[model samples]
Target: MRDLTKGGKDRTIFIGKSLMTFLKGHFERYQEIKKQLGHEFNPNDLIFFNSRGDYLKLRELHRAYKNAIKRAGLKNARFHDLRHSHASILLKKNVHPKVVSEQLGHAKSSITLEIYSHVAPSLQEDAAHAFDEE
Candidate 1:
């Protein structure tokens, strides 16, 4: 409902086909639940919501995230760490930093590079090896 932080524009995050397939199934289940409850389906309804079809409060979201982390046997990770992890994975896989920056809604690609500079040394080595291969 609000503009994106860096660009003050609507941001779009493209999902993979697998995720789209899973979301399609999830939406069908939601529709079935609404039908059984005799509730009119509102397309504008939040995709993830409480049993009452209300958006979750911040505390509720945090609690659910904590529970998920515990179930996954992960420690010392905040929800925001997922963002950092995603960017780190993409950068390590040789995705352009500028593209990752835009995906992350960073004000500048430099910000993305600065934050993920730990991945740069391996990238530099990879580039050097590529030239040797050629």
Candidate 2:
């Protein structure tokens, strides 16, 4: 069982159009698979399942993520880094820090800044130019 303190938090992530379409198709297929399973299915089904159609374990998810990066020839990093990347991308676009922190499930903006400050270019811009004499 997941520790409620760690796993019970809710966060919202933006869905791109392509990802939405993909999720729609995935759920359609999921429904079909559920029908094939008939009454054997449980009500608490998982979004991602193992080959035996059981809920996926976290270790399985981590293993697959590691292998995917290896196959793609990318530098390996913790999956947590992806959350930072997403926040950084949003912050770079001048999206609000509170919004980004919420999306990243951070308790505060300080935590977001601590984790993703390097990726946030907002701090690097020279606002001094706004009132410079010609």
Model 1, 1-134: lDDT tens per residue?
Answer: 66466557777788889999999999999888888866554435779887667778889899999999999998968999999999999998999998999899887999999999999999999899989998
Please report the TM-score between candidate 1 and the true structure: 0.87
What global local distance difference test value does model 2 have?
0.75
Over 4 Å off, model 1: 1-3, 40-44
lDDT values for all models: 0.87, 0.75
TM-score of 2: 0.71
- Candidate 2 regions with alpha-carbon error over 4 angstroms: 1-14, 41-43, 120-123, 126-134
TM-score of each prediction:
0.87, 0.71
Clashing pairs in 1: none
Query: Residue-pair clashes per candidate, as listed?
Result: 0, 0
Which candidate comes out best when scored by TM-score?
1
Error of 1 at 130 (Å): 1.8
Model 2 scores worst on lDDT over the 10 consecutive residues at 125-134
Best by lDDT: 1
CA-RMSD of model 2: 3.8
